[model samples]
Target chain A: MDRQLVFELPNDLGCIEGAVEFVLLRCEFCEEVSRRLRFNFRVSLAEALANAMLYGNGGDPAKRVRVEVTVESSALQARITDQGSGFDPDRVPDPTAPEQLHRPCGRGIFLMRQLMDEVHYNDQGNAVTLVLRFQDTEALLREASA
Target chain B: MAFQVSREGDVLVVDVDGQLIVGNRQELKTRVLEELEKGEQKFLVDFSSTGYIDSSGLGVLVSLSKKIREQGGELRLSSLNEDLRTLFELTKLDSLFRIHDSREEGLQGF
Candidate 1:
């Protein structure tokens, strides 16, 4: 089975938790995605949404963030678009670097890349797509049965 | 998210409940700084009841860790659930901060 969700949320941090919960609940109904996978996806989605709201839209309530989520038997994907002039993802500093470790910012993009199977950004950088593929679903089902 | 603070000798233990995401991360940072301003140095954040944390939450933790260290103090964490534990490990933050199996162990170190 395949499912999809689309949301246009304001640039408000208060809405992030509810959006994350909605994604996780949607994942629960998809059997092909395991519990562990759902948890990981939740984390990645949260980071992406935060980036769109805080960095992309600068938390402007007038601006909006658009999210599209698709869940299939073999994969899950989310595309987030923000209404601000985009910046280059390449300029983000590596949080793991010794010098950058203490900084409180710049970890969101890194985490989105780390947790998701694939992360892509548009040229303008205002939009990002996150993908997670599930290979060998039969094996996963068997393991769950065991 | 909500935070509860208690003191064990010189260490201030913060028990966090609910999701640690963007909106509430600043509160966590501000509270920690407030404690720092009070000259309370040794810090332990208990995540037993915390179900979720994003990069913003991790950033706050890193910031608090650095702020505490700059003040000649230390920050420790305890009781992270499996997901958060893996997050810390994936980010290699496990190497940056001291993580304990329990609050007692964290307190013992300070």
Candidate 2:
């Protein structure tokens, strides 16, 4: 069975905690997700939520950030969208560059890409989808028995 | 998120608990800066209880690092679990800060 959750949050950073809590609570209901994978998903989702609230919505309290999450037996998917004008993710500087290492502007996108198995942006750049896949535990147990 | 600060001689040990994400990162920054203003030079952030951190949290740490250096102070980190350690590695921030396995080791460095 597949389960889904949707959240509509304001651009204010105050709502970030609630958003994270919601995702984590849903993860508890997903018995297929391992603890390690849940941790990874939580971190990635937090980054994405920050980006949506700060950059995508320009931190405007009036704007709304929409989040949709789906949990399956082997994967979890999250789509986050904002109301403001979008910017290109490609233009974000490499935070690891020698000259840029100390700069803090670009690490969010880098962490999102590194932590999630798949990351895709809409053509408008205001929305992003992150996916994480895990190995089937049942298959692993069967293989062990075989 | 909450922070508890204690002094071990000249070193100020900051114990941070909960997720260090965007909303509460400013609190961490403010607390550290306030301590820095009080003539404390050596600092250690103990993350043994920290479960998660986002880029904003990392940025706050970097900002604090630079601020401490400007004041001729040193900042060290200790007790990062596997996930946070991997985050530092992925961002290549592991090389920029001195990371220790225990609070005693971190305090020893400063």
- Candidate 1 residue A120 Cα shift, in angstroms, is 1.0
Off by over 4 Å in 1: A136-146
lDDT of 2 by residue, A1-146 (tens): 23888869878887877777778776775655555455667777878888888888888888999999888767788999999789899988889998988976579888878877789999999999988876654465558779
Over 4 Å off, model 2: A136-146
List chain A TM-scores, every candidate, in order: 0.87, 0.85
lDDT of model 2, residue A100 = 87
lDDT of 2 by residue, B40-89 (tens): 89999999999888888888899999999999999999999988899899
Worst 10 residues of 1 chain A by lDDT: A29-38
Best by DockQ: 1
Clashing pairs in 2: none
Question: Each model's TM-score, in the order given?
Answer: 0.92, 0.91
User: What level of docking quality does candidate 2 show?
Assistant: medium
